[model samples]
Target: MKAFCEEYNIKGGIWNDSNFRAILEATMYLPVTDKDYRKWLNFFFENCSYNQLLFNRIQLNEGTENKMFSDRDLVVQRLEAKLLRYTDAKECETEYCLKLTSVFERLDLLFNNSWKKDVLDLITRLPHEQYNQDEINKKLSFIYSNEDCDDVLVQIKELLGLYDFETAKSENKSEIRELLKYPHYYKVLVITGTTGSGKTFFVNRYIKYCLEKLKIRDISIIPYVFDISKVVSDSNLEQLLIHEMADLLGKSVQSLEDASKLLSYLPIKICFVIENIHLIIDEKSKWNSLISCINRFSRYEEFKWLLTINGYEYYALEDISNFLQRYCIEKNSLLNISKKRLAIFQHAVNMDELNKEWHVVETILQKTLSGRMSNTYVDVNKGITTPLEALYFRECIEGEEWVSSPSTYYEFIKKIFDWKANKLAECNSTTVQSTVLVIVDCVIEKLNCVIKDSELNKSDLSCLRSVQLLSSTITICKENFSVSYGFQQISYRIRVFPYWAAIMVKNRFRSKEFKVESITGYPAELKEWLIPCYIFYNAQNENALLSLFPALKKASLLEYALFCAQRDSSVFSKALYNFIIKNVDYIKSSKRCYSVFYFVFYCPLRISQKFKLFTSIAGKVKEFNLLNLYSRVFKSVVHTSKKLKQLKKNMLELAPCDVLDINYINGYETGEVFMHLSNNEEKSFDIVINDIIAYIREHESILEIIKNGNNSSFFDFFIRKCMENYLKSKKKI
Candidate 1:
């Protein structure tokens, strides 16, 4: 055992203790005489703690120290008698009976007739020992005898199942009882909001307040925070309440059901605060069922139900309005002034956080009151003038100023009454439509011009133009429209397909596949140009494309070449030729477009070798087609295709005016022209090579790159040659 521990690198003296016990148990359980077993037991007893030895002491009442053992001996005797009766029934096999008897004998020695002896005796006496009957009986007897046995068993079972009890308690458990003090007045208090509005946080805080501040003695009165989100089907509301209660209390489900069954008899007062009641509303006929349950419990003065949801209007409870009215009347709960009830038009508005600007709020209130007054023709000189009366009176007074310093609440009330009386005199006067159309029309016209001049791509400009057009058309139609109808119409249009399309074009480029020829005069070879042009059209408009046409054209050629090179060498060459051929007529018509063409041919020559090989050939073919078509327009034109063919024909035609050696060509005039063409072609190839290098560097593992036999060798050789050349140039031998 020592060697085994050393070989496994096991550390700590504690591990040795376990090993020693295991070895001792093995020796005792071996097929040996009782004397040998006793010897094995003695070895453990000699080294064991004094408490362990005392616990195992079998000689009951032999000394004062063995008093516990004496009591255990009596318990064991009772258990053994019970077991003997079961064994006499012949429910167990002889072998199992023998084994059980042996177990009891071992217990007699090990426990020294302690409290555990009875447990062992009960185990031995179980009827069908061969069929695990003894094990079941022992478990039953142990649970029945111990007061906290069920809880302990549950904890052990949870631990075996890997449930984290500490985490569950911290996350889910909450207690609420403080609200009971105002139970009659605040019975139907609701916490309503959208998801992530901190509804759960508020509920948890309320629960904590109840537990700590209220110091409620009756745990049963504590609120059971139920998550109705889990109630997918029409579950018994009573059963669900009990299940949630059990979860909160950390009690078994069966125990909870039993408690629930006896709830009517138990004098337990529970406040249920259900979250996500919308889920319950989804279950068939559950709304009325839940309402019935709440009403039944509400009859008990102590029972309270606090239901929360995102919106109240969504609830389809039968007689809900009447129920709410009755509850509010009975509970004396104050209903909050809803957004709609307050006649506030705006759902949300941005305001400077640091500054208090109540203009919008005041305006809304004033307008609502004035509209009501105009419609009713009521004399504002009422006995008790409300805030609504004051607003109406203010509107009627107009230029005439009425002033009064109301220091006290009563004085303030008197002034309001006086204002209402004045407004009543002028009540049946007139109603005016607020016309802010001229300013809106001017803004729309300015936006249209700005959008047009911004040179946005067609898509973006189209969207902006659509929005402007729609807004103008709607404004014209709504010249005498009601404010509410106008607002609704505008909102509806904004959400409609045409307006949505405009928004898509203005913001994101249209993702739908469409043919280039259908929209643009640009050829397919100029896809690179057309795409960005389209993006600009979607983002800005046509004005933007015209302004950046030269740069767009150059970019298109370069991009097209790079794409072709990457995909297929032959395809890239053909595409490059096609681009030049298609644009030959345009180039002939406009001399300014020649520079763009020159740049396209220049990029391939200056690019990296791998890209250069493909682009150079393509650029030559493209240049040949252009020069051949426009030979008459040039003074000293070089037909480079014939020279390039000749260079290819001659194995050692050094410095030939071919695509490969276009960069090396000399002369102030010819060199300038050649450089311009070579640069664009080289740039196109450079882009391709750079992209490949970036991809390889990012994704290919260094180890794999280095291990790649031929590629690695070639790269290494190139590096060495470059370094040698650099050294030679520096004269560093």
Candidate 2:
């Protein structure tokens, strides 16, 4: 092989002389008289492992004859021993070892075909020394045999049972055996109770008992735990269950269609524990589909089903009475464990005792209501003296008097139980408004901010505040402002007050404009936050704007343009035109107002006709005989306008020149000005004009500017001059 590989440019070698010899010996037994057999032998000798070759030879012997092969049995036993030795060498975890042992058990079941005596002897000698002898003997008693019962098949069954129990517990072995023995009895089990009634616990315990006590392992049964909570959408419950089963079994479930295709191939004897069956039951159309699927499972001789639900007897059982009767009653295929099971559960949780410890009951209730509990407050009438009548009452006892009662602690337990029951009952019917109120209250308390629900306007602020409050209520808001908002909304409308007062109280000290800027972007940030409050105040009182002091001061010239853009886009355009015309002299005289105008007009009005107006005004200012200040201001304004137009095009497309829009514009313009000053880039009027045209084309919403018949040609002339000046500047550069 090495010489041939060298000649053909291939690398090949064999290691372990004993393994090579084992492959050679195994290949000799492959009935190699035929060409195909001889070719297979050659391939085996060339590449197969010694253990694989030995296994193949043993399988061939087993397949050659109908009778059980002793050689095959001995080889399998040796393979099992080898696997045990390998596991021992690594000191594998128990789960790992059990997986290896399961493979051996499967092989023995397939190849070791013999009487009970031989199987029992093999089982007794297996390396899994943890086999329960008593359970094995009990399983052996069930294996039928003729005169002086052949112990081989009986022993094999016992061994298999013991192996399966040690490897992985079987959940529905007893149910299957009972069904097989008493086919006339109903096999269906319908378990129902109130929420937190321990139905799931009872079913799990029953499954555990069968796996430990009966030792009827190797029963191909799958216990599927189906949570109906996920079935809210239009998903097929059957396909979902099958997919879940495949996932738990570590098998491929590519799609719902694929899951359906694999369902029939699944082992017939299986237990499906369908939890929260009410989800399907309530959707009548879906209930029909679910029933159809269940009927199919019932038709299989070995299939068993278990359903768990809360208050299922309320509607589900009644709705599906006919279907339930046919399968559960006539077919002896259903079992109703709701009532009897509840009694058993009551015993488990000790609910029968009236004198339970408050702490113990509280812990259990808390666990049961995980992710569902809400902090709720009930108003109490002044005349009501009993605890039950009091808003914070513990059960029926008066809050003050309850603590003095002999059963005070028990009363607390009863109160929690009653509260939990009421909460669960209200989950579906609670109004959106009431729910929002509850959530907002909790959020406010958590944030240490006092808030009253009545103070908030439901129609205006409810939608936004409710979402923020609920998110905060869930303990997801870790930021300081978010927490403060929750507290303020719940306790008081701080954002509604004058910006200065709100800031002073909110920041817990004297809050300057600069300080406010540090916390919330620039003046625009404070202005935007005040808009909603202003709108709310305006809606209530027309002169509400008078109450807004800091907001008025914080509203820079640019923000004023934006505020008009939001409230009146037409007014915003006109105001922007006048502001640019008035500021042209100042911007051209010095760079002080140039930055402010660049931010207001060039940035916000990039897509508006206001850009043309600003450029035209700047050109007029530069043309007029003022002083050297006019030239300097015009240069600064023109330079900054070029960069501002470019920055605006990139950041804002068809941006509304409103306060909100200008806030984003301000940030972009600031960055652009910084970049220009740092890079010392020369500016061109043509470049600036072209940038504005490009921005206009991108934001087609502003194309109306070109169509406006009044002074349309004047706008064109203004842009043409700017473009000419820009191209001239570019040539110089």
Give the TM-score (vs. native) of candidate 1: 0.24
Clashes of each: 33, 28
Q: State the local distance difference test value for candidate 2.
A: 0.36
Compose the digit string of candidate 1's lDDT tens values, residues 1-733.
Answer: 4543332232122223223322333333322222343454465455543665443442222242233223323433333332232122212223423433443233222211112222222222323324554554445444334223224334323222222223333322121111111112223445543322334444554454334322322122335565564443334766676665554433354543354333322223345777645544434476667766665444333355656543321234323754453332221112112333321111111111101122322342344344331211112232212223234334444542121111111222334334433432332322210111222222233322111122222222222222222121122234464574443121111111112222223333343443232323333322322333343233223333333333435434333222222112233333444454445333322222333232333323212221223222334434444443222212122223223223222211112123322221211222233333434455443453354345336544432433563332322332343344435645963
Candidate that would win on lDDT: 2
Per-model TM-score on C-alpha atoms: 0.24, 0.26
